[model samples]
Target: GQTPLAAGIAFAQKYNGTGEVTVCYLGDGAVNQGAFHESLNLAALWKLPVIYVIENNEYAMGTHQSRSSAGYPLVKRADGYDMAGITANGNDIDDVREKMWDAVQLARTESLPSLVEVKTYRYRGHSMSDPGNYRTKEEIAERKKESEPISLFKERLYKEKALTEKEYEEIEKEAVMEAEDAIAFAESSPEPEVATVFEDIFAPEDHCPGRPDRGVSSSDRKLAMAVLTMREALNQALSEEMERDERVILMGEEVAEYQGAYKVSSGLLQKFGAKRVLDTPISESGFSGLGVGAAMQGLRPVVEFMTWSFSMVAYDQIVNNAGAIRYMSGGQYSIPIVFRGSSGAGLQVGATHSHTPENWYANVPALTVITPAFPDDAKGLLKSAIRSNNPVCFIENEKLYGFKDEVPEGELLTTIGKARIRREGSQVTLIANSASTHVALASALQLEADGISAEVIDLRTIKPLDIPAILGSVAKTNRVVIVEENKPFAGWGAQVAFEIQNRSFDDLDAPIERVTGLDVPQPYARVLEQAVMPSAERVTEAAKKTLS
Candidate 1:
């Protein structure tokens, strides 16, 4: 399940540890993949500290490079990317080392990525399964005789009087013995235990102080609260975190000079200066991967996508690299980065620009996904996300940015996995988050008029599900209705429905019903969009069905 393109991009993007250079070695065949082109484009554009070493052995598996790729030489392809390109004789150890060292120096000092194609040959077949049927035996024999790396180097050493025959033989024997010992150790190892199969998917939880059961303290309530828009609240949170920790930086399109597309980062550049609040090119893949690299180098980076829809460009880096880096590296690296932006259909923007991605990221185990309902949760949760030692996908709604609500003063950190019961009742449970939380609250008000007490739960965090709160509410109500703006197929509501049925099946009096967006591309027209999105009426109707 390894994507070399994504892995290489991730490595180059984040390999700035201790000002060291990252050299990514790949076969000539990888250049054909789209991710390879994308990665190179970003690296060259950003002047990233990376060296891409393409080992061109003349053939890609059974096909010759001439037949498979375009252009004269593979290194020449770097011209289109506006980066330095060079070639070296792979059989000449000194030549290869000099080229590689030059590439490393350029990347480290100039902040430029280089392409180095080593002219080489592989004597054997591509793999053990291959029968060496594609090339002539004479062609292979000629390569071994004239250009084999080891034999050519040994002869050169002897001609230079670098070592006597006996000394060379002793060195070869020691090398063989070391390799044999490594093989023996590997062969003696036992298979991993079956119980350990699920280990290391996510780092062990470093839980914050606040838990749902603890409830807000009386002294906590006495803290000052300000009525601020969701955008202002988020801005305040980012501002506070930046002030608290100088390592925290923000980067995205229009985040600096233009303030923000949604004005969520207004005044940040004025306060923190250009370096901390950077405005990047409109390349999501480039900037997002850069943030990953920056975070890997012991800095806290907050990367904002103009819209979650634009995040598709950087999906590979986000899901494959940021989500898996910690686990893949055996907890050696922590991608303490936040990828946040507006999500879900609300504006009349076409199908491509609208839609919620909470479920998409929530499906990832190593990521923490948060979709807060009100301004207070928005501020608190975003602060927590910034402080967290894990990759967090903070989903905000475009429709709710201007919506105003009260937020607590001073340092506030909402627990990542906790759900708050916005309104408590005992008849039926209404579950939702973000913009849809308001829908559930409205539905509860109508249900109360009809003499049905409905409890409303705002699932602040999507992953690390608050199963206890969900089960407790469903167990009391004995009936349930889930609401969400996302489509029904594999939606967050469906997962909530399954959780209720799995643990509170006996307590339920009726099957759970869900009110969600219609299974179709969101319409651009206002009337059609309204018809498709979940409304208070739809949720109330579903709640009544559960009651009936």
Candidate 2:
């Protein structure tokens, strides 16, 4: 609830360009949540043009503020983050208006976040079902008499002669009539069609799937054969895209000053300036949500999660908000944001730091999931993801970042949800993506030595499944073995296996086999980690088994 509110503030601060100030109003209860502090800290740290207003009505759903909060004068909490803090008399409209205007102006001009606490008292119980049992009626009546906001505003307006008593009565009558009209309209409104609920899951007319035709001339070998590492390829793509679009921005922990945790964004900050290439604080949900908001407001944001392990912390913002916002808004908004980072295990980082969450991301409807295997794909697919009109989870492998290969030069873009035939053969099709594609490629060589002609397919994009490419490969081979680093249970390979079985069951010569990671947390030991991951040896064996 309040998390969305904070997310809205963070989004607006980063994305809103109309010079219109964004103010997020939250109840006293919201301040106790971790997201509240996380958002405030990020807002202050980033110096975002945001105003956070806390409605300190003193009760967090029947629990008194004194019981829940540790300190008095709630505005003082802003001091901890070195943010500007002020208290306003909520009962007086002049005080409220003046404080809000000051905070908004400060945020807009200085790009500084401020906290404005409006001290007020609730006139009624927390909800309709509850009675006035928590506090005395005398106390409630006394506070209402002393600090009623509407009464105070009316009194001031009357004293200033802004309206005559007759005009005030007419205004009150007009308000009542408008409220009655709204209620009448609601009651008379027709029920929505059942099909309407499913119409807005993604932007209409944006879900076509086909292999990319990046205009690479077959005769131009020089442009198509420039060797680069995955890091270099990604950097080049980011640079080209940022140069092409003024609204494209990069933000994440260590993305600016440190040039990305993996150095993939090393030269971007210097090239784009600190404003576009932002180095955000270690608040994944805050920044990710901020990116979502910015995307909604017409900016293309590339948010790097140092790893998907850290992105798990921002799952709510990513899945619930980013994935669903377009559908929830009935296709009125398209979230053109990319959440990318190094993913997978192999660096002895233990279970927490290493996880292939491609399956998790792919599970969400309307999300475009990409796991590029090599340098060319890393560059091309990332460029496509940046240009995509949907939220994309671009999964990059840290293990493959250093590996080098020739990538096409000049402007190149790959299609999302397309699979590439890496190595062609006749016997069995081995499907993989990201780091596991290397294993499949290696296994293909081994299979050749064993006299088994294995066709290897790199599933560049995971979400759309590229069923046509896979079916085409399956039709040729009649046998299949999928390789992936994700665990055996509910893994991406499992989905592929199911689809292959359903779509190409008659084409199959054997049951679909899968070479996947062991169903356990990635271990810390080098040998053990290797054991849990899919390997060339395992994939080779699985390919042979499919033939046997």
Candidate 3:
């Protein structure tokens, strides 16, 4: 779940048969989630006078409905639930409204969930880079010609003389003018003032939900195990934060139902209740949009995408809406939202799943990116992320979640824009983040076997990277290697290299080097996946290259 579409459904169902109605509009792709099935089953069993509107655009990315789903016209899936279902032409507003009217009538009369599928085609590609190799441009153009909903409605309105030529011209002019006005307004809006920086991370203690467990200090006996592993420290952090802030709601698919796919959110729902610990209908776009909306409204939403790769479906909300809101709204609103999950290679998750989002999101201007390698850093960075007033992408390594570390107790927060010195040495600086940080430290040990005193710096934050640490080390050591489990071109390491070169070109003894994942996508085979990302051997090799 991206935000709380299921919560919305629950809200709608709560009002069913009371002369109130709830309608949810979702893309055809959302049906692929297991949560959708659960929601459908719940709606069916409860007979929650709800209308499920699926905006079936025929394709989920390049994977068409036929390939991604076994069912045709997905509405018919309601047959299993014994609910009434109908398909409508989404391009026709009249058709949609008419079917909606009928669906509502049926739900009201029978107190049952009604499925309405609206067939439409997105005029644009999924997210701008789609080459349309999956579907021919001619086919897309034909779909556009036949199914351009807004224009289709306009045509219908004009042919019936519901609007004369002059009126139609007036309508077109008005729409264009309004769109132009919005664009101008957005552009002319002043940039956020410096004071606005600390505005929206969380509601003030008085306004926010739950009083801080002013009592639970690092000494809480139950949290002693936190000293054993960074994973336990993270669990303790979640417990303390949740106990401290009632309004800090956790939502995502399986976060509640399955105790989080990674066990980070285990037993959260039992403690927080469904209101705060929501389980979403695996509609990433819908739910993530809902979280964006909820954050804008007031709630401190911690949205967990199982994997950053899955975030591909909701990139628009993350980049366009969340990143642009404070500036777009003239600092009148701040989005106190956090999106976290695993990234990079952990196993044979393959090309589709094993991706590091460092370059993808770090390039965005407004986002705060945090990727911690060790457990202590993870707990501290995650706490900082949760407390910060800006949107954050808190990335964790799939391999390191269970790694152990001695985390200092107390209300500890490792500052956002600072780097950690993992090992102090004068030979060379090995800068790394997330899973690569450990590899850097291990290689530092391995390099010690040779006579190189390697210095390792854990760059906790990617966006506001601890440049001073990097430059200071580079000035002293005069050589550096940036490592990560991501592709080389336009990757995070590239940006780091660019920044260092521009700022400290005079300090380097030799050219900076970066050890990163292969240029190709990670393969499904274990050996291939291992080969795709940087290893300790590769880090050591790259370090030696700089030394040589």
- Candidate 2 ranges with C-alpha deviation above 4 Å: 1-17, 123-146, 151-170, 204-223
Ranking of all candidate structures by their TM-score, best first: 1, 2, 3
Report RMSD (Å) for each prediction in the order shown.
3.1, 3.3, 8.7
Stretches > 4 Å off in candidate 3: 1-226
Supply every candidate's count of residue pairs whose N, Cα or C atoms clash at under 3 angstroms. 2, 1, 6
Q: List lDDT for all candidates, in order.
A: 0.84, 0.85, 0.75
Which candidate would rank higher by lDDT, 1 or 3?
Answer: 1
The predicted structure with the larger lDDT, 1 or 2, is 2
Kindly list the per-residue Cα lDDT of model 3 for residues 420-486, writing each as its tens digit: 7778889899999888888898899989998899998888788878788788888889999998778
Task: Kindly list the per-residue Cα lDDT of model 2 for residues 1-548, writing each as its tens digit.
Answer: 33433544455555555566667889888887766787788778767777889999988778889999988888988999999998998877788999998998898788888999999998888899877688889988999898888777788889999977898899999999999999999999999999887787876435333234532112224455788999999999999999998778998989998999899998999899987898887878778887887788778889999998899989888898899988888889888899999888999999999998999989999898999998888898888888887899999998998999888777777767778888888999999999898899899999999899998888988898889989998999999999989988888888898898888899999989988899999999999999899999999998999899
TM-score, candidate 2, is 0.90
Q: Rank the candidates by lDDT, best first.
A: 2, 1, 3
For model 1, how does the per-residue alpha-carbon lDDT over 12-42 read when each residue is reduced to its tens digit? 3444334666777788887776656656776
